[model samples]
Target: MERVEPKTADDAGARADAYAAGPLLNCLIREVAEPRPDQDGRRVYRLPGGGRLLRVRAGRRPAEPEVYAAGGWRRVDHAELVKLVSDELRRHTGRANDELPAEMIDSRETLAALLAARDAATAPDDPYLRSEQCLVTGHPCHPAPKARGGGPAASWLPYAPEAHARFPLALLGVRADAVVEEGDTSALDALGEAPPGYRLLPAHPWQLDLAAPALAAAFADGRLIRLGATRHDVRPTAAIRTVHAPAPGGDVFLKFSLDVRITNDVRRLWRHDLLRLRRTDAAAAAAVAAADGPAAWLSDRGYRTAAFAFEHLAVVVRDGLREHLRPGATALLAAALAEGFDGNPLDALSGPAVWWPAYLRQVAPPALGAFADHGVVLEAHLQNSLIAVDADGMPVQALFRDAEGVKLLPEVSRSAGLLPEVSRSAGWERLVYCLLVNHLCEIAGALTERFPAYDPWPAVRAELARCPLPEIGDLLTSPTLPGKTNLLLRWTGADGAAARYLPLPNPLAGG
Candidate 1:
């Protein structure tokens, strides 16, 4: 087991502080701070509202933060950094968020705790599992990525996927009369036998714990029965709420309702979202299937939830990677590729010349084809996308998951319409942000970090150029791309899922 404990010299606090500062600094730089003249090696940025000068060792991961104070620069630790951010946001936005400041602190502390726990915790042998467990930073741009509903550490630490936690799902027997289901959820039936007139419903135990009091009446009235845990434990993927389990019929993945707020939304199988999962998943799957390559969609098979505990007990079955992956290829989480792991293919890259294009070829066309031909604007973000690689660590296929994040066009289906879905323009903006800014930018940053001599974007331009999609015309020529403003959004107390964009220089239109 590769235990990822913090090094003795850095200590837990220092590692967590550095990890915490990166996202915060990135957010500050992107949303509020304006770049000043570079002084020596320190990249200095001035806050617009107060003309406050902040300097840091800049790169993909900024560090050694300092704020200009008195006459010289004063060091700002993580805690002080949060205070600095809160004060600036209040000045910049003309609004003060009582909650976000605390969340910023909580996020940092949570990372520290996760670092200590992961260091002591034994890593899973499965490289995929290790990759899934590797998102200790979670969201790269969120102000409070790790705030687990602002609850106690004990509540979330035990089930944290980042700590390499794996446990069996809590099973419940819903009375046949009370079981509400859609599509093919027969997969749940094979998990465990539910006495004579009961249907098996798997629930995230943490969710069960959160919703237990509400379910007391149902349990008492025999509407639901406690059927114990699954025989085999399921490993949580990077999504945290979704878990991967190896079953008799190959491998299967299950996504569960988690009441806690993860990054953007409450990590629940929301009643409305669940009601439409089948239709959304079907649209995405068909779009991917229509594309002429190894690209695949991990279909959200179906869901089963008790009528009374509709949102609380919901569980959606997702297709496993085994059937979709090409022979002799293994799938790795794309975010893991960006954040790095024990064996990230990006780390071993000799140069970007060969590696970059192969990646673009495997990743770009499917997403472009889906939008151009199939009206499916995939949330092709880092976390939702996976890259399957061959024996030589070359990307051979691109597999995307999470139908919940997917957007469908009005033309895609009017009768079975995903009504109230984002507009085509809105959807395209999201796709550009998710696909280009969030997904490709990080990977490019990673590759460029190692092979700075080689420019990765000309090849990105060429790969995207290969796509016959007309939108590529503007995209390749566009001067600016939309960058999501997380710091400003949270500071303004806007909904996390709600996007606010700022113009970013388009790398495709290189100097």
Candidate 2:
């Protein structure tokens, strides 16, 4: 909620110090091998690694503050900061308590405390400068620093100095019924050439914001998406994108789905399908009973979701390197997402819950009897997860998509009296496929290639060792199937580099 601005090098430095309040052990200024100068007489310090920098710039809360990068400086404004920080904290903490209490505080308060500690540890003898300080080089912006890249791209194009910026919500004007075709003309080129109505303008958050509508209209009467005449058909990238507006420092993505119907979709899908279908709710309650447990461990951590909307989701804009990450990081991330859950285990001795058993346990008559006879559950497989990473190139958060293939647990046998047999059978089929073929294979496969040092399944076993249910840990390490499964990857191709399937234990051996 607080915005800090500093005009001179000294002022910026002072603000940074105040923000840090102490030197951060995890934070270090990475001096770009070569420094670049900015238009407004500032030195851009590009820190490649370590924690985030509490950057402050001259001006009244600049719309987008200039960010220090290797190439030079880029604009990342206040709005951008809010979105980047908010999304990251949410994903890392995996809980949504935006307003951190003085006690058990995690996100915002954690950041504030870290900053304060960093400021308090600053060296008093450090050289003073009229301009702000740079952690990487331990220097201030020198007049006439060498120029870096061609002057920033034209406003129409996107740029990011930090990891946060705006992206074009280009709503091209196309017929309501028209479908998007490949190789359509470039929307960017067309917008630059067009005049007046055809001109491309940056999308405004308010312009797209909407409140939840009547029950029937939200889903039953939703409008078909109409294409724009000059639309760019680009899907979101695994890597976060950074965009800039004409303004000095532009806003970041801050969208809120005001539609309650949309929010309800999230609840039904996550709470009912994933949580309830697999008995995670029961497991959660159980863990709370048996001293500190996984569910209890993650109890009060996460980001914020503003007011409820009928059907809504929000996005933030940021500027950072968008590239393939290191293999080690990918493995760590994939395992984190899996949370030790596997469809099959190799060793019967290990005691973690198998995917099938969890489903069966959750679908017992007592659990399903409460829902209206018509309620359905969706099974979440690997493909459905969309992971968002932070600066370290690690996955700390995930989004589960695809809702049509919902179903019931297999244990729930259907009787023709109240519920239709077809609905029950269909639900069971979806659950089996999702758990066995879809979620299990994809995640295990990725882990095999990503991490060769230690078995990913075994690592999951290690984490579960601390769980309240040690028997569940034993089940996890045990193989559910009779023989070796051809699941591990074998390096193949001309250079024997491509990966192919090989046989490995079903679940890891020994609990």
Which candidate tops TM-score? 1
Measured on C-alpha atoms, candidate 2 has an lDDT of 0.27
lDDT of each structure? 0.85, 0.27
Which candidate gets the maximum lDDT versus the true structure? Answer: 1
Report model 2's TM-score to 2 decimal places: 0.25
Worst 10 residues of 1 by lDDT: 1-10
Q: Please give the clash total of every predicted structure, in order.
A: 1, 75
Candidate 1 deviant stretches above 4 angstroms: 1-10
Off-target runs (Cα >4 Å) in candidate 2 are 1-378, 409-451, 463-478, 481-505
Taking the tens digit of each residue's C-alpha lDDT, what string does model 2 give over 178-236? Answer: 22211212222333333333322222222233222322242243332222332322211
Model 1 steric clash total: 1
lDDT of 1 by residue, 1-511 (tens): 1122225535888888878888888889988889999987999999887888999987887777999989999988899989888888888878978978888888888898898899889988877788888988777778788777777888888888888898988889999999899988877877888999988998888888999899999999999999999999988888888999887868889999888877666788888889898998888898888878889999999998988989889899988888898999988999898787888887777887887888888888888788888788899999999998888899899999898888887877574665857677887898889999999998998887777787888888888878887777888889999999988887776786799999998999853
lDDT of 2 at 470: 27
Q: Per-prediction TM-score, please? A: 0.97, 0.25
